[model samples]
Target chain A: MVSSPATARSFARQEGGAGLRDSVWGARELLVALVARNLRMRYQRSALGFLWVLLNPVLTTLIMVGVFRYVLHIPVDQYWGFLISGYFAWIFIVHSVTESAGTIREHSYMARTLAFPADVLVISTLMSRILEFVLEIILVASLLAVFRHGGVPAAFALLPLAVALLVGMALALAYPIAAASVFFKDVEFALPVGFTLLGYLSPVFYPLALVPEAWRDLYSLNPMVGLLGIFHAILYDGRVPPFSLFAISAVEVTILLVIGRQLFRWKRSLFAEIV
Target chain B: MSSDVPRIECVGVTKRFYHYEHRTTTLQEFVFRQLAGKPLHVRTPTFHLEGFDLTVRTGESVALVGANGSGKSTALRLIAGIYPPTTGSIVTRGRLVAVIELGTTFQPELTGIENVELYAAALGMRRREVQASLSSILDFAGVDEFAEVPLKYYSSGMRSRLAFSIALGSDPEILLLDEVLAVGDVSFRAKCYDRLAAYAANGGTMVVVSHDMDSLPMLCTRAVWLEGGRSRLDGSVDAVVQAYLQSVTSSS
Candidate 1:
């Protein structure tokens, strides 16, 4: 129906304000479809196809675990399990952020012609990483059963909570990078290095306890460290993370997400020009 | 005219873009001094739109005819809410779908059907709504057979046809056409004109941005002639098109 002229004029900003909210709710289907298409297209042309999904972490874990466990004499039972849980979670974060930072550049075609929230592109990037993580979880579960000679742990009940935490964290982290990368092309170039440094500093492969006592307290301030701790608690320790770590993870994720979302929303209108 | 409301109101709506003087070579230059804190700089940035004004009522199709750099697309971007005006105010009601730069919007890796869902949804159609519209859209584009194929594989003609079909099918209250019809095949072009004609007959507001004189009268009732970021003429399509054509012919 034709919206009256006056409404159209004022609606530019009002509808824009509402449109920003509606874009989140309205674009859900497009988001799912984009992610699914990428998943299928990525593997369809590969010779090894879906096998790479299982082999990637397995091979990485084998190399790391063997080196640290045999050569470095790190305790395999606690430490290997610790490394596995934290590293995979870290991989998901790094992969999602790095891939999503260039989402607008990669999908310039859609951005130029269509009017939609750019967040959907960022979501698609996160979605693919989530798919990979789900596969990693399945592989890790099977390995745990095979190696430990035990069925899945009871902490598996916390899977939903872990996923919720991951999604919130991804949203908080990815949008600002994704949104800004449009104008700042260097963001894409800079993310990989930043992620690698983050992996080393965030206790992805090493235990947080290895840090000097003085620094350990400050390093826990890295939000990913807390998130990784949560993952280790549920998967390796077979329990919920401490309330302190959980609270830190939640607060940091919430703050980053709110800030990232505001920045993204503020920048969204200008994207068509700069991009 | 309704005493209370104009369907669209641009009270001195203006837009100015910052153009960089030189492409910075290194990350240091690109980031720290050059890129970080400036939207406008005196070294090279030029402000284009001093004050652009226009208003449209419901069911009014206003063609914004201009030369290449006359800011037609910029105006449409402002109206679509894709880009906020750098200055002044713009108010618009209803859903606005801009069919500018067709085929430039689909994700290269996505299949035709997938791109259709994404593009249509971007226009604010719900998933169920797009699914309902999908068959008709594909049929209209005549690319139904290639529905599952990746968009990167589609020919330019096929892509434009599909893009146009989606844009037209969305039933936008205000449709912005930015020379999208100029690229498709002859028959496809004819079909687009026919569809646009029908859409206009149904009282859908439209704004066409084009340099094509022949096509203007066929699609528009009123036209605005733009030159060097200024409106040179605004009147019936025939008068403006004739005036533009005479000026161009004389200049050549």
Candidate 2:
């Protein structure tokens, strides 16, 4: 059916928030394609293919478990369980942020030629990482059920909320970082160091209790501190996180998302020219 | 909704590209500049288009003809909404598909058919639509035999033919072509011309950028000759092409 010229004009004249929504909503298929492209490219030539998605986190967890449990001997019961519950969540953030940082530059060709929302590139990167994270979580949950003597905990039901919160946080950071990377090539190079620092700073392998009492307040200030705390509570302790912790993280994620989204939108138009 | 309303309207459009002389593309350099009280980067604006105006009514097939750096491609890019005009406004009615750089969006590692799906999706074709057109797209590209082969294994001509096919598969209301006919063998080029002529005959609006002057009259009824960053002439394809050729030969 032919659309009225007035309807076409409205589509052409859309701007600011409304335009952004339209672009994203209209390009939903493109988003799915981009996510599929990323996943396909990642596993395209590899011998193991999809196995790496499952094996990667499991292997990393084992190495961390061996070091912290056997070599370093950090005292924590069901250490592997404790490690993976929080470790998987941390890896999700790390992978998403690191990959998102370079997403715009890597897909510069599409950005330059195609008229889709640039945000889709960053969002799809996060989506693909989220898919992998979901797979990793399934692996972690099943392992916890078998080894912990108690089948998957009741709090496992809250895993989706936890995943949602983590995804929000990842997206919140990713938007600005991806935009910044387009302007400054440093973002791509600097992200590894940042993630490395963030990994050690957040309680991925060790418990928060292990940190000296004096540093706890400052360390808790890290958004991941509260986020990982929830992951550990649900998957490690088989209990709900404190209401205060969940509330604070939610508020923080929302605020960061607004800021990141604004920064991305402001910088997005310049991308085709700059990249 | 009225037929009187032009399908495309560009009034006083201008685009400027900043060519950086000394740019800081790293945080380290940026921070050091801040500490040293120096500007982060120095750039000069180069106008690619200045007060460029165009209007295309329904069923009008327009060709932009120009020399290198004459901004014909930039004009098409602006019209395609790939780049926002630095000044003025552009209003385009209907779905637009631009075949600017063929196969640029295709992944070399992906199979020919996979790339076709990816490209079609990028052009904003729905999954069902893409699936419906899959066989026809492959058939037109003449890459059906190597549909399962990775794009890297296909020749450059095959890759572009497939790209062209996918872009057309969207069945866009407005089609923007940038020298796409330059690719593929003679038979394929003829097939493309036939398909495009059919598209125009069916009332599809088209804006094409091509250096192939001979093909312009066959494809477009009207032409705009751009000089520097502005439209120098707009008239029948024959008139504009004749003027542009005379200018080139006189200059040479």
Candidate 3:
């Protein structure tokens, strides 16, 4: 049986210039189907099901607000609102990196069998997290609107812009760690520890202002700071942040993404072997 | 091109695989490994292909016969562009699909239908196009009743049938089969071979690597015998098969 010329053409076009065009493009449909399967399997046996998407973030945000605002007496209104916004964003990065580190290793069977680009696994894993992140964004935005204190701001229009920046940052952080975990098994152990340190050091728990003034500049080098700062500004402050902050964030995000992709490619061949 | 150029070609290709220790019991050994400038016990990498050369023309069904670890699979992988050669190069001009580990490509958690779509998509079919052919593909795989079930639940025969169906369903210009005939029941294998015959009749090129010398005369126009990653004989399937079988029987 001959595949239609139209199907072949469309496949070639999607591949564009990559050497893996045929394999990668061919796997595209399968990628979507597989992802849908993963999504379904994830929700299938659980009693709570999809509700957990909303419930998990809401529960975590409540805990953070209760501890920081109620116990610490931070005196902030709509504190759950603020905590929810930042926590959801932080979770996106944490969850993506935590799970994706061993993506190739976990899928060793599929990797050896199918001829699709190995990067498709990375892309698929990222996509599942992204879908979940979108759900979190919607839930957090709805909660903020319903609560009505520190209500939705005009600057919220920039939320998409902030989300784009964070996604780039997350992908940047994930690539090298994912690649290294294939050969350097120690990276798997170190990843959780690194995420824990990054959790406290970044603005996930406390506002950046809490840090001593002299050390704040040094800390901003943590790209999460730039990402979280921008997200918090949009939700809590209701204003577009200063241009300098956005500019610095844009530069840092670009560098990390480029380097990450390079490292991932560099170690690509070893995946089938080591994994 | 006057059929001068080989449809499949490999020039002096070499591949090596390093073996790593299963587990190091102590941190001292781990540290000492790097400091010692060597492994405590290093297993030399096995060479799958070494300085191998071969050529097959258009419209030819080439059966590659070799014993276990004889570089048959490695050569096929190289031809399919799955792994680059450590030395030399592999050059080809058409789409190639290797039916190596069949349904293993399907994620176990996903349903059979989902796997068909995913595998088809990876081969470069668009979502809608794949959807249009979805029912037909399932019908051909003959597992329509179990289409909705997850792949992990499928029997080995069912998996083999489905994988072969999907691989052939795509209609690639070049097909590489790695001992897939050994899978499934006898009737299913017969059906697969019949389908493959039709595929070859349609001018599709095929390269099959198998230990079944009896089947070579029926399937292949010409065959190549590989030993230690080198071609030991090349001729009509019957002659090459006879030579290989004779060599093995006399040696034993």
Q: Across residues A1-275, which tens digit of lDDT does each residue of candidate 1 receive?
A: 21122223333452422252246566676677777767767776476877887787779988998888778886447566777777877888887777887888788766765666888888887887787788787666566555653677777677667767877887788898888788776777788888878778887777777788999878877888788888877777767677887777788889999999999987786676667
Q: For model 3, what is the alpha-carbon lDDT of residue B65? A: 93
Q: Which stretches of candidate 3 lie over 4 Å from their true place?
A: A1-31, A44-47, A74-77, A146-151, B1-5, B20-43
Q: What is each predicted model's overall lDDT from 0 to 1?
A: 0.75, 0.85, 0.75
True contacts kept of each: 0.35, 0.42, 0.19
1 against 2, candidate with superior TM-score: 2
Q: Give the DockQ-based CAPRI class for model 1.
A: acceptable
Fnat of candidate 1, please?
0.35
Q: Model 2: clashing residue pairs? A: A5-B1
**Ordered list by TM-score, greatest first:** 2, 3, 1
lDDT of 2 by residue, B181-245 (tens): 79799999999999999999988889999999999999999999998899999999999999999
* Candidate 1 error regions (>4 Å): A1-11, A14-22, A44-47, A76-78, A149-151, B1-5, B23-27, B30-42
Question: What lDDT score goes with residue A55 in model 2?
Answer: 73
The CAPRI-style docking tier of model 2 reads acceptable
Q: In model 1, state the lDDT of residue B11.
A: 67
> Candidate 3 clash total?
12
List, residue by residue over A180-199, the lDDT tens digit for candidate 2: 99989788778889989988
Worst 10 residues of 2 chain A by lDDT: A1-10
Residue A219 of candidate 2: its Cα lDDT? 94
**For residues B111-138, what per-residue lDDT tens digits would candidate 1 score against the true structure?**
8888898778667776777888999999
